[model samples]
Target: MNSRGFSRRDLLKAASSGFGYLAFAGLSSMAAGAGSKASPLAPKAPHFPARARRVIFLCMNGAPSHVDTFDYKPELSTADGKTSNRPGRIPGAKLMGSPWKFRQHGQSGLWASELFPEVAAHADELCVIRSMHTDLPAHPEAYLMLHTGNSQFIRPSLGAWTLYGLGTESDDLPGFISIKPTGRNGGAQNYGSAFLPAACQATRIGSEGQPIADSQIGNIRNTKLDAAAQRLQLDLVQSMNHDLLKRERVNPGVEGVIESYELAFRMQGKLPGVMELAGESPATKHLYGLDDPTTADFGRQCLLARRFVEAGVRFVELTHGDWDQHRGLKAGHSRNARAVDRPIAGLLTDLRTRGLLDDTLVIWGGEFGRTPHGQNADGRDHNNKGFSLWLAGGGVKPGITHGQTDDLGYEAVEDPMHIHDLHATVIHLLGLDHERLTYRYAGRDMRLTDVKGVVHKAILA
Candidate 1:
């Protein structure tokens, strides 16, 4: 006691010791401000009725050559080893014809090359966009463009934008999850939440060259303390954080930290069950090509992606890499395709059989496509003027091809779809008007589709 009574400092100092419980209770209630919410990942309704509830992105990391895969150019084949003149061509660059054979398949009779025979079997389900183009030819810039819409600026990724527009359905797992992500090119910036809340960033599951089954969350289990003890510790920490928050102004970063802690605590109870593959049947395992060494790694990624989306994870990305074939195109593409072919087919088939296809959008593509012009003896150069990507499920029109590349597959001559347009179309399918889904940051209202983007209604069902 000072002069008349005990000082505030004395009370605080005492509370810091044995009287901590009293301080904890008081601070907790103050932090919660009336009726507080439990999680930031709680499900929220879309801006309008949505066709797709979740999205799975099969990122074929290095640019895949559209001329050899989906787009068939007979004129280029005719001009094979001789080239001399095409606008934008290096003066003496020669034309290169795809060595793979193109065939028509399914009731829709979609044109697909032998490079993706397994995927071609599901031609009726795919919506192939042959004239997909972006701004850059380089991997880093093109990758950033495809993921964040702007190649030069730091911006929130597509997954981050989706989470902001429509809150996630899963409370125990993170809304955005990236499996086997790469460290090259744009790196984490591809999935990073630039100006958005930190919680919106993707939780990386596995690294390149690491098997998904072998991946484990860091610091997930606490062997030192039991559940009850852990809870007590967490509550104490939360209370202290709340007291600090109350003493200072409201900080978004602080709020995000609190949410992350609460989420991590909740995930310990649920995430293990989802990650475990022991419960899956033998036939299912074989279907994912887990029994085969060549397909096993990518197969595991596909299967895990299915499980995640089925469990209500808003966005899940599976990456397959080294598709950039500047040399040894035939051998490289063949090897890369073999690694992912069966697994991709199995994923689509599984999703269809499980009836998840109606509400789940599956996207397959790379940063850009390869040029029709020859680089080394057999390989093609990078082409940003025209490429291809395909979408299946969700509300997309099945068994259809939209847009077209010119005779030589050099550029998008008909109905070219830019990266911004693709982003706009995706959000539109999810029932978000790209124009309205804006976040005020820095000075103006920023959006996924900056100032341009038109929804390609032709592809919608």
Candidate 2:
């Protein structure tokens, strides 16, 4: 396959420089978990006592309608067909009320529309932030901003930052796992490591709509080589990699490959069992709504997230769809809601029952919220001015709404929280002060929240 007629293995068969002995020693220790102390994925102490040991970010890719989902505004409902006189409002666009009814749920009685009845049942565990705002209304920009602190420039993602700071609890598994992510809008940028060590990047399991039933990690497996032969091959590859590093002096690429090979070696033994769900009870599958065809895809992601977190992964991200409905808001949002509602609720319940909820921060929201006003037709337009998201478990104050939009649900009017602040809070919950958790890159200190963001201490439990 190379320019040289012979393979490296074939060429190296006659050469010996103690490379085999050195690699075998390193891999043997690594397999026993003794070598992880020198690894970048080794567990590290937090900056402070962390409220959460892990994070699960439930990302709804397309903007979901805040007015229809979580931020129920009766005023917006009453003034359904009214045109806006507000500046910057689109011309002649009428306000559209949510097709579903809003009702109080759980002992907390947080207002949520009928679209998310399942999630509403866990209202007592939810800390709903009603007045969430972001930098842009556009999908690509806001989506990027929601994941990485900066939109215009490539930056480490939230998961990457978390993994970089905490270094994960497991050496056998990836620190960050992104499930069923969409390769659109922000694409890989949403989970990329950027200037951070490539080891901090997320290990994506599957794409958005693709069911990962037989979906194993795609490449690097040579069916012909057994575990021992593979290890020997990897030893040779790693020796070459280290040789490159010695020559180049500080090559992140080579360093990342070296680490990846070792991790892959260790993962081959554990990951297949983790991904297998045949052992899950029928009740467990039913709990996640996996029995239903409509909800199966997202349900699978949610369940895998739980398994991954339980297996000591530090951060897990599950993405579900283009919630962006510029037209047919009711039908589209309804379908989307039905798909994720039970699965999300099941995740909450499962975590709590397993005692994982106490330290597993669960976040649910999209890049932005759809506007109260219709976009020419019946659908809501993108509204970066205001939106909503909810946090549960971890250290968040439960069953309380901390902010609000105006009565018309047009924009955040009180206790408005920006995306930067949210990022700060997320990092804070994971025991890293966003300001202090910085990586030196390009002669500057880079952080998840950048120079912006103040943790919303009021929402802290």
51 Cα displacement, candidate 2 (Å): 0.4
Each model's backbone clash number: 0, 0
| Best TM-score among the predictions, by candidate number | 2
C-alpha-based local distance difference test score of model 2: 0.83
Write the residue-wise lDDT of candidate 1 on 268-368 in tens digits.
Answer: 78778888888989999999999999999999989989988888789999999889999999999999999999999999999999999988999999999
Deviating ranges (above 4 Å) for candidate 1: 1-39, 247-249
Residue pairs whose backbone atoms clash in candidate 1: none
